[model samples]
Target: MTKKIRLADVAAVAGVSTATVSRVLNAKSTVATGTKQLVLQALDELGYERPDALRDRSDDRVGIVAPDLNTPSAPEYIQELVDQLSLRDYAPILLTHSSAGGTEKYLQMLVKQNVSGVIFLSGVANESDYDVRRYLDEDERQIPYVTINGRNPNIGVPDFSSDDVGAVKDSVRHLYHSGHRSIGLITGPERFRPAQDMAMGYRQAMMEMCPDTDQTVLHSHYSVESGGRATDTMLDLGVTGIICGSDLLVLGAIRQIRQRGLRVPEDVSVVGYDDSPLMAFTDPPLTSNRQPVRQISSAAVNTLVDLMKGGNPPRVPFTFRSELITRESSGAAPNQSQF
Candidate 1:
């Protein structure tokens, strides 16, 4: 005859009460981590199969969902996030939305594989209009997730992001001090939270510093080509300084400016966001906002791990400050002293 397992047997082996073993077996959140480990060890020693949730903990796998690898900012943050996860003894399974079937399909696959948790890097959660019902619906199975730089609050998860508004405000101030009077902003679509913050900062700074000039703000996709098109409009508006949402956008702006026979910093000065690697090597170099990738990645991993271990979600999103890295791309207005 096959022998059946008993809670009393597990309790005796773990040196805890049957209630504690029962709690651990049921995957109760109240069970302490040490207590849970002890009960699991007892079950293992007694040759009893662990509950599915308990078994899932041993997987130590985390799913990372991000935008296309082609995007300038994607790779840097992804690399840091992977490093952080690995340092915490978790294996990262990277899934780019550019892949076949996109984020929804990959998310389901991760769930089926029983990943410990999922991390989203500038994914659908960052888009204001994207429908997240599948993830938030009560009828569906809930998955543990955390987001980096996410804007939407309805996703109901912990978010770690940069203080975009402050960064833009600082960048605008830098340009104004550089003698850029007719300043313009070229950023991503307003639907993205970061773009919205950038625009808000631009508007606020213009009102404070250049209340006499019209606020020249143009929204576009976060790409080099889009930046070029927006730069053309700014040039027509007599803008002598420009702030872009990303470093890639700044490159496009510079190209368009050169094509028009205007030199960067002489005809127009420029600033960029997301100071990715090797920005200093650009022809004139780049002056941009540096996202604190390492700190954000560490905090993101810690929060996700906590959630996987049954910790409560953070009440508010964690926002980190960004720094402006000044470089050659930014300078004084036309005929102005660049001091």
Candidate 2:
């Protein structure tokens, strides 16, 4: 007779609680990937057979392609996408693209894997420079897919993105009311649609509120170091408020502000986008624009799954607005700083 598999035994081997082992056994999508791997290894070591649900099923797999996983927002997007897919009885195969292997390689692999559908999360698909042809098959037939938070106009696929223009406009108006006339904008490269929208909003808002002031804007990579350099320039320009593209950039700006012996809000009020996880925990909790992450992820998964089921969703892109979360990082503008 085969020995009965015990959750407690597996938990002990995996160095986790039995509840965690149970969740893994039940194929719960909420478990972290690393924890799930450890549980599977524990089961193997304990001579237990794997659950049918945990077995490889390429037919049940949906591909999720995303940019740099190092970004703080990436994990949240991944987890939400995975959970939504799993709720519909689909498993997710995550492919994170890097400079060494662009998205083309992963898309080709997903094609060969026979994935049911694909969902893009803020990647080359959103950049105007990249051709949407990469998403097509050899005969030029498009694959069933959905994009979250950016779209290429060349491809008529279902897309869900935040209202980047409105977000920046709101941020600018907020700063203007706070007595900041000289506000600067820091965002990603112009090639990305979100950044372009933000730039447009910044120009529009600046024209409306501070007509005479120059439309101060700096484009930078979504990295801490790049954000710091951009902030240095804005500080030198004597801007009283700064709006950054991402929370990571805001962190860099905050650090740069301190290094200049200035206090956040007191010397240089800052606002961040993506109100990503842990923003509220920063030294001065970030004031940020909160993207509707869960709503967008759920919609993307549902739409893609529907497409896989032969249901036709409109090819038009859907845009969602963002909420400005006021926090400690933003305040009434201080007296003109000695630049």
Candidate 3:
């Protein structure tokens, strides 16, 4: 005769209190859906007979929560994430974040649908004021999840991301070496972690590389129009080289320079971040810092698969280095050029 698995056995495997497992078994509405599903998966893995409701509501979907999907980098990472998840025989359902609370709302919706797991690309987890309690709730319920790029230490999950600070510093250093003394930065709002880190790196690099000059940072929207405006502002201030926070910004800055009857690398040079797709095909073939998208994406997928199989990945963020790819957009700083 087969032995029956007890609540303690399920709780042990799921890493939740036995009482919580009991609540899950009893279909209590107070229990978090993801937590309940965790207990159910644990029970099934432990060879325990599952209740009828759980057995009937089993789903094979994976939820991907993204904060925003307007950038080229977003599509690049999403495509790779989708391709990797496909190999595991899991279909991806995109949950585009519509508002600040949308991430939590979508998480709840996905939990109700009983997804296999979740991967967060952009969400509240990256916010500066993030609360770990929300993620702790996910842990209590047994939902496995992974994050790409930004990470919160209290979340205690694997976060695959690139080195934003190093990338910006390297770009600044390169421009400094190319004879640019009056360097400036144009980045998005300060609320974003990437922008904040990049700004910090630029300030540090400027203090170390060109200590005699004052560093300038122009805050702007992450769009073509805004990039152009920000670039014009820096140009008016006599910046010989501009480091842009995004590829779109690079394109816009270039347009602004051309509109002022100045040639790239001759009058004012430009450097961009997030080596977005087709950057090499731009009129000047933009210079940019490459994000380890393929590496980070594959690592995120592998980590999620391990979590689903009851394996634990390191709770720390796995950081990858960003490489500077030089092209036509950046060159030696002109001495008092026609700006």
Best candidate according to TM-score: 1
TM-score of each: 0.82, 0.80, 0.81
Instruction: Score candidate 1 by TM-score against the native.
Output: 0.82
Error of 1 at 194 (Å): 0.8
Worst 10 residues of 2 by lDDT: 134-143
- Cα TM-score of candidate 3: 0.81
Residue-level lDDT tens digits of model 1 in 1-339: 434669999999999999998888776768889998999999889988776657744358888888778678889998998899888889998888777266557766776667777788874556522434464222133457788888567666778889988898998899999878788999998888888888998999889998998898899998899999999998877888999999878989999999888888777889999998978899899999999999999998998888777688674688999999999988887874322
Task: Give the alpha-carbon lDDT of every model.
Answer: 0.82, 0.85, 0.82
**What local lDDT score does residue 99 receive in model 3, on the 0 to 100 scale?**
44
Residue 337's lDDT within candidate 2 is 75
Report clashes for each candidate as comma-separated counts: 0, 0, 1
lDDT by residue for model 2 (126-168), tens: 6522434554433122357888876767767889999989999
